[model samples]
Target: MRPTVTPCEDFNAEEDAKALKKAFKGFGTDEDAVIEIITKRSNEQRREIATVYKTMYGKDLVKDLRSELRGHFEDVIVALMLEPVEFQAKELHRAVSGLGTDELSIVEILGVHDNDEVVAISNAYEGLYQTSLESDIKGDTSGTLKRLLVGLSTGRRDESCDVNEEAAVKDAQALLQAGELLFAGTEESVFNSVLCQRARCQLRLIFDAYNNLVGHPIEKAIKNEFSGTVKDALLQLIECVRDRTSYLATRLHDSMAGIGTDDRTLIRIVVSRSEKDLEDIKEVYYEKYGKSLAERIADEEEVPSDVKKVLMQLLL
Candidate 1:
């Protein structure tokens, strides 16, 4: 899947910096200019323009955006300006730091990203927050969820492409013994160990083997066995492996399905996926929801007008 936002062929960081300065210079901000310039360039180019803006005019681009823009529009622009890992880490930090823990955000982020990307996210999390992501998860969560997240935070998943059928069968048995084969006292450790360590390809084989052993899909078995957030987390991990595009499309739907939209979740998914598989996500969203993602955004009256346009631009 290709990114929606490619590197602009006629990109000029300095000129962009100047244009942005002009937009923010006097009176009311030129909202149209701000949206056009920010959304037109790739994130990397935006970073370059930020650098040139600071060097040329001694003003921070993000700070200026914050000063000029208000509400969700500012949030969208500020999110766009951040490095992807930084933005993700910031989201993770926000998810855990507040009074109420957002368990799904933590699960979704840790589950979806690959090993190297998770490692970078964890490192950035540590750098930004002065604490390990594992420590935070441990402090914020308990029992199975804690163990699962701590395992993921280590970023030690075996990423080898090869699938070992013998091992997969063994893992399948372990999973069955953990939950499906047992009526009481399900083994969370077994679930954690197998799901956290195996490569995605190996996990797929393990899933197939589990289905063979259990005479039903692994997701159904999980639903019968586990409950609550842990269950959702496990199922979501499987979903990510099965079809990440659809997983994200579902996340987008989750963010928007309810009353008074989940702006943070919506923003994070849209901004994060803008440059990676967003096209596929949009296609999946339409295929799944019976309406285009752009249409959904447009219809969300809760979304500010400027922010809606910017999101639609990313879909382009």
Candidate 2:
């Protein structure tokens, strides 16, 4: 995985803070300097800069950025400035708090993270909002999706890399019975238990065994048996476990294709993954869609040039 922002060798938190203050002080903000400092520094460095900026200027860095920047550029900068876990927690809160839930955002976050990451996000959520992530998910979602999100937020997935072939076979049969056979309606618990608790490696084995036993892929069974948000969540889990990069690539494509762009989704994926697997996502996107992610974004005449420039920088 290639990250756009790695640790800078000569990083000085105080100096970066001064530069940011200077950028914000003048009549017109030096957008380029703001972007250069915020996007190029590592997350840890950005956190440090926030602390120093507060100590030096008695002002909140994020608040200052919010005052100075506007539109998608502001969104990208603010998202990048936040600690990763806090950013994710905020995203979770944003997704679930409104009148209608952004189920895809909930799924993207809750489905993809591993046990440790989930635990961190849950903790961060409580810390930020003084409310439990589980409660928020339960309140926002209903039925099977509620159960699935709650299960995912538990952070109880088996973390072992070991694959139990015997257990894989048993789980495969269980999944087949629960999903594909006469016992279809009775499988929600089974789906929750196996999909939520098993390690990704073990799940892969189970999927292979399930395909061999049922004569088709587990995803096919999931699509045939489940519908609506529940099905979407389950399929997201499977796709994330199978190949996270590909899943994210598909999501990025979905955000940009046809109609108006899902700017929130676009910003979330680009900012969140830029320092993780965005390079891989970019490659997969190009391979799958026959156009580079950067190229696609550039083609969108509606997106601000500054925001597009930052996104392209991250992609590169």
Candidate 3:
């Protein structure tokens, strides 16, 4: 229940604005001052600071920061500055807009958000790009993955915590029959249909019931039955339904696991979750991996020193 970043005590908009102006005034940027103000305040507070900064001085804070900062640190700060929903919208747009597509980015955003957040992201996407996110996704993706992204964009899933045990039982059977019980190939539609509409709470019960029905875990069956991006998304949804914190921790790990760091992915997760559940994510990260999330990031040679320092400011 603890978010790493909280609203600062004795916050003053003009004072913060003045401090930021001073940070940007000298020969060199006061990165520590920038990081301190940006990381300590909540997103709402940050927005207020930006507004006051603009009102006090005719200069735009983001533009000034842009002029002063460079590289991944700038990316993180700017991303942090946007409204969360808007940031998500831009991330989705980025995921689809460029050559090829970052299918996993779509999954990361769409899979994690609930009905309202999803709708908000969709609206923000259109507002920012003056185009529909659904169309962009359709253009970029195909097959079941396309369907999944489009489905998630609707924000129609039941967002309640209410559980229906009987329905859960039937859904469990439907999954078993669709996957493991039938030797005749899996019915992927059944998965897509059920996953698209079921409430997260209901999905959890369905998963539990499925486990009880099948001797093994539902994840194993999913791995056996599905393939490609859809399979990864499904597994992530299941993971989210099971333990969101652990899922996010794995995401943090996966971002840094390979040859080079996924700076955008890393920044998005840390920044988005920083004020929400980074604390819980950190706990899960430590419990899953031997080292803490900060320790993991700190060890990554790819992350620049300033980037790592700013990241640690958020983490600790």
Best by TM-score: 1
Record all residue pairs in model 3 with backbone atoms less than 3 Å apart, i.e. clashing.
none
What does candidate 1's lDDT look like per residue over 1-316, in tens digits? Answer: 7678888899999999999999987789999998888888888999999999999989899998999999989999999999999998999999888797888888789878999999999999999989989999999999998998899888899999988999999989988888866878788899889889899889989999988997888999788878998899888888988788899899888888868888888888888888888988988889999999999989998888888988988889
Best to worst by TM-score, what's the order? 1, 3, 2
Q: Provide the global lDDT of candidate 1 against the true structure.
A: 0.89
Which residue pairs overlap in candidate 2's backbone? none
Tens digit of per-residue lDDT, candidate 2, span 60-139: 99999999999889888999999899999999999998699988888899777878898999999999999999998888
What's model 2's overall lDDT?
0.88
**What tens-digit string does per-residue lDDT give for candidate 3 at 69-122?**
999989999987899999999899889986989887787788888888999999
Off by over 4 Å in 1: none
- Candidate 2 TM-score, true structure as reference: 0.95
RMSD values, in order shown: 1.2, 1.5, 1.4
